[model samples]
Target: MEKTYLRAVEVDQWQTRQDITVTIPDSFDREVMASLPSLPDEPEKAVEWSGMLEMIGNASGVLWQKDAEVESLKTQIEIQKKAMLDECQGLQAELKEARDETHRANAAAALATNRAIKAEAWLQQVKEALASGFAPHLGRAPVERPSVLLAR
Candidate 1:
């Protein structure tokens, strides 16, 4: 059967390379490498498609390497996605805690403001009572005092 894939090259022909190294699970760094036949090296014999059939097996080997690289990339993507999800969850929890703390602080400030208003009202009432008590005697004569009570 003819191959569905085209030629795979050394270090792969993919223009974009991965920034992170991916080690596929269950693959302990074992791989196969092969070079396909090219133009005549010595120029002694001219052979075209006659012997190109032998390179089919080599092509399949290279194809496996490409497949492994693709699989590794997929695994890395999944891992990064999961990590981002976890970080988001943690940030959400922190945000919730900060909101709760803000609410509590606002409540405390309101309570303190109400208490200050009540204290100020009490102080004003005391001042009014003192002023009124002293004002009644402003125009009255001084009351006579007994000699016995003033002697001490």
Candidate 2:
């Protein structure tokens, strides 16, 4: 059995690309390589394994807090979206109601105009009958004839 140590180096400035060469204890490297998994990209797998351990140990709480915040924001956005949709529906209903009222008012006005036309026709018929001294047979007396003969 052998012991292996992990090391990481920091850079002072950003670089376009960076490569690291790791130096391992001679006996530790030989032992670790012998027990390695049979993966095609063993180097990348080794790096991922090291990262997983570090994340579990140090960054779990930070990741959990960020996830919770994101969920809270999503819930608030959904609530706001629903509120906006409800308001739009209410406005649409009000507009439809107003249109219905306008249609009813227009129909009433048309009916009133038709009634006025019929009343005017009746008045003209009555004027002609009075001028000609015509009386109905329904027990109604004749209307007074115009007084052109009164001067005689």
Candidate 3:
């Protein structure tokens, strides 16, 4: 069995009309001729496939160009997809870092709150000590003294 490499191609319906000519492979030409009946130079009845003939006349070397353009666009789409994925990953990483920082800030705030509570208790003790008038030689509390407000 003989194998022929053939690629199925699609072309844009819009084609140029510059009177370009093309030659098909001999085997393909022979096969087409053998399979289909030949059209007469002049026919009495209207041809069924005459429209297809006119369209084919404009599609000789233009299909490859459109095909290449399609391929290039597909490549660009893939590149854009990769870049978007990378950007998403970067954003996710940034979110994780922000969450970590938030947790650290919350921890620091809790520690500060605890220190403030302890400091408030210590300040209360100091106020009591001051009221008692800490005099080591005298006593914890002095006898009832005259009011300075009355003296004034």
lDDT of 1 by residue, 1-152 (tens): 23233344445576643333322322221221113354466656644332353465456657767787998999999999999999999999999999999999999999998887777767766666666666667964444332221111
- Per-residue accuracy of model 3 over 1-152 as CA lDDT, tens digit each: 23223333434558532333344444654565467765587556544343444466446335655777898999999999999999999999999999999999999999998887777767766665666575545665543433232110
Clashing pairs in 3: none
Worst 10 residues of 1 by lDDT: 25-34
Q: Sort the predicted structures by TM-score, highest score first.
A: 3, 1, 2
Best by TM-score: 3
The TM-scores of all predictions, comma-separated, are: 0.51, 0.43, 0.54
Full candidate order by lDDT, most accurate first = 2, 3, 1
Q: lDDT per model, in order?
A: 0.60, 0.63, 0.62
The TM-score of candidate 3 is 0.54
Error of 2 at 13 (Å): 42
Please list all clashing residue pairs in model 1, or write none if there are none.
none
